[model samples]
Target: MDLRAGLSQQQSLKLSMTQELSQAIALLQYSAIELVDFLENKALENPLLHIKSRKAEVYQPKAKGQSQKSNDKAWIEQISDQRFTLADHLFPQIQDMKMSPFQKRVVTHYIYHLDDNGYFTGNLQDIANHFNFSLADAEECLAILQRVEPAGIGARTLRECLLLQLNRQEVKNELAERIVSEHFSMFAEKKWKQLSKLLSIDIKEIQQVFDYILTLNPKPGAAFHYERASYVIPDVMVVQEGDQFVVRLFDHILPKIQFNKDYFASLNSYQDKKVNDFLNEKQQDYHWIIRSLEQRQKTILNVTGKIVDKQQAYFEKGPTFLKPMTMKEISEELGIHESTVSRAVREKYVQTPFGTVELKSFFTNAIESVSDESLSSSKVKMAMEKLIKEENKQKPLSDLDIVQLLKENDGIVVSRRTVAKYRDQLGIPSSSKRKRYD
Candidate 1:
């Protein structure tokens, strides 16, 4: 029972993170776009930071008819085409509907509750209570909302969404409607045997009905929210020269940052200690940030260079040649932590001879081959995809059949369950679902 406190000397190893180290870690994780945005913000905050602008050389055509003004006008028109959002598409239709003020208000509230997928998320009872309206009125308003341009705009569930679309078909499909309404769970699960027995319909007819159901738009509002196609901006470009691949970074894509020399020089003349201290602190921050940026670029280049070197077979041949690799392996080789390697590759893209690919895509789990050598899971998946593509639609290959095919052709040894898992990962339907009666 030692109740008295006594001072004792002890030695222990302690790890601490400095502000600059923390900043470096954070900067390393930032994607190219994010890094640019961060630097822009920092430039605004630090008066001593300046971003150098690299102006592109504009070419003027000396031809007879072409004019710079016309090009400028065309460019303006291209960007000016407004994107129609789901709300924008539906609001105008709502205004055109002839409804009493109270009804319109209730309908608008319901519309607000509709999610991006055009499914109602709010409780009808809660909405009715909030609006001081009867449940009957709310239901009527809901029906009216559903009748808008998109057939399944206000559905509560997937079944309801499909049923709404089914009801709008030119040819009445009573069987499809019944399947959607009553046996939706069974239909979704693809229990063709049970469905055929229950409905007293042949498997062929059931297939036809299922095929028709597939044509219906599950997310009706998705069409209205037009998404502009985004193009990938590769952070690194690999160019093949003789026997070696030269790695080039898209440094020009990022803003060139430099210290504001004139501003720094002006600060030296300041008499106030506080002013000098503030400038000095800001200068240190500016320098540290610059060094971090440089380090980030260097790390990315080094990591990507190693990846390119290792995945040379993939670059020379195709995706099928991609070897199994992990972050741990790269981290060990580079003498860095696994997390650091992960950060370096995250959201990064590399432009190769084949195409621009995500850096993360290069790393995949290894599958054991017949020769006891490890094979990339991606390569196996690619092989599986090829087999499925060439498969007879009438008799789609089962997971067991795929495993056999891989063993015979590719000399790969994988379980049926693994094949099934890979197929699922590839978004391929089961054999029963994929089978065609024709």
Candidate 2:
């Protein structure tokens, strides 16, 4: 050990502040879909930065002898730009109408209550009471909003929404109208025989009505958004050339950024200490942006590569072959945190030979059966739905009956409450609501 003129020029290793910045970038890139939104907001706040629209050429990693061929495959691009909700679409139309500011506010409150499907979960009376408006006034506002572009925007229930649209069409089929208005539960629950008997209609006619109901849009407001507006650009590509799967990133379009040479050139011209320090600070910020972008790209590629390796069966076959996976699995595999894995897959979609699918859809939770072998919850829910479909319509299986059936037949001994949960997940109505005596 030698003590030199300086206290000892010993080399030491420590995590830099830039390492945290790298972690932040990794977190953002992993969940780019969600983080992209936050980034967009931040860009609005920061004068020096902006979020550029995703370009097609930027979708593949730059590698020697890689295919630069454009994909002819059509993808369902997410409409990311300003989407006009039911409120945005309907509020302006009501402006010229004979209504006071108080009445306008009441209508606006009801608009907020509407779900993505443009149907109000709260009752008209409740909305009116919340705003201290007359029940009649609330109903009037709701009626006007419902009449906007989306044929059924502010109805209290699914049945009311459909009937309102049907009424506007001048469709004179009384039986069809009655079925939609009164027997939607029976139809949805697949109680065909009960509906047929109750309406005194042939089973064939009831089947026709059932088919027609399926054609109606459940979420009409979603239709107003343009299909080609914006989309998710996959940070990685898994290519199957011959029998091997090679994973790489799309990096060609990402502009290789560095601290602006011109800005650095101008720095030496400034003699003032304050001006020099300010320029130096901005230079660091520029370096950070470049490094952050690089880290973001690398982390996305690494995580996506792991995902492709784990989901090989899904790539080889289709969605049915998608094994039950979780954020935990990816985190453990990559030696990262679970939250990190979650962020990486958020709003991210990958293009495959099968089709473009969201990254999150590949992961599913498993349900434990009586044999202790785990089954995908989606598979169990599907099985429950199938069982309900084949059940006797006149005596639709109750949740308790469903539990017994699962235990005896399917070897799945789930509790009645669990059965109810699965039933609800399947969008199946209860036996009491589903039953119809004729």
Residue 278 lDDT (model 1): 84
Clashes of each: 0, 8
RMSD of each: 3.4, 10.5
lDDT of 1 by residue, 140-206 (tens): 8898889887899999999999898989988999988998899989988888789989999887887
TM-score of each: 0.87, 0.56
Clashing pairs for model 2 are 30-343, 30-344, 31-343, 31-344, 60-250, 61-249, 61-250, 61-251
Best by TM-score: 1
What local lDDT score does residue 82 receive in model 1, on the 0 to 100 scale? 84
Mark the regions of model 2 whose C-alpha exceeds 4 Å error after superposition: 1-232, 250-258, 369-373, 400-413, 436-438
lDDT of 2 by residue, 1-438 (tens): 866666547789996777546656454654445555554654554434444655554244446875455232212233345656556777787676677787677667777777767777778877778778788887787776676656777777778877877776656666678888888888867677788888887877876676566677667766654555475566556789998677766543343333345645666597889977776666565556556666666666777788778778778887666666787988898898887777767766677777666777777886666786665666667678888899887688999888888778877667899889878877788996565443
What's the CA error at residue 309 for candidate 1, in Å? 1.7
The residue pairs found clashing in candidate 1 are none
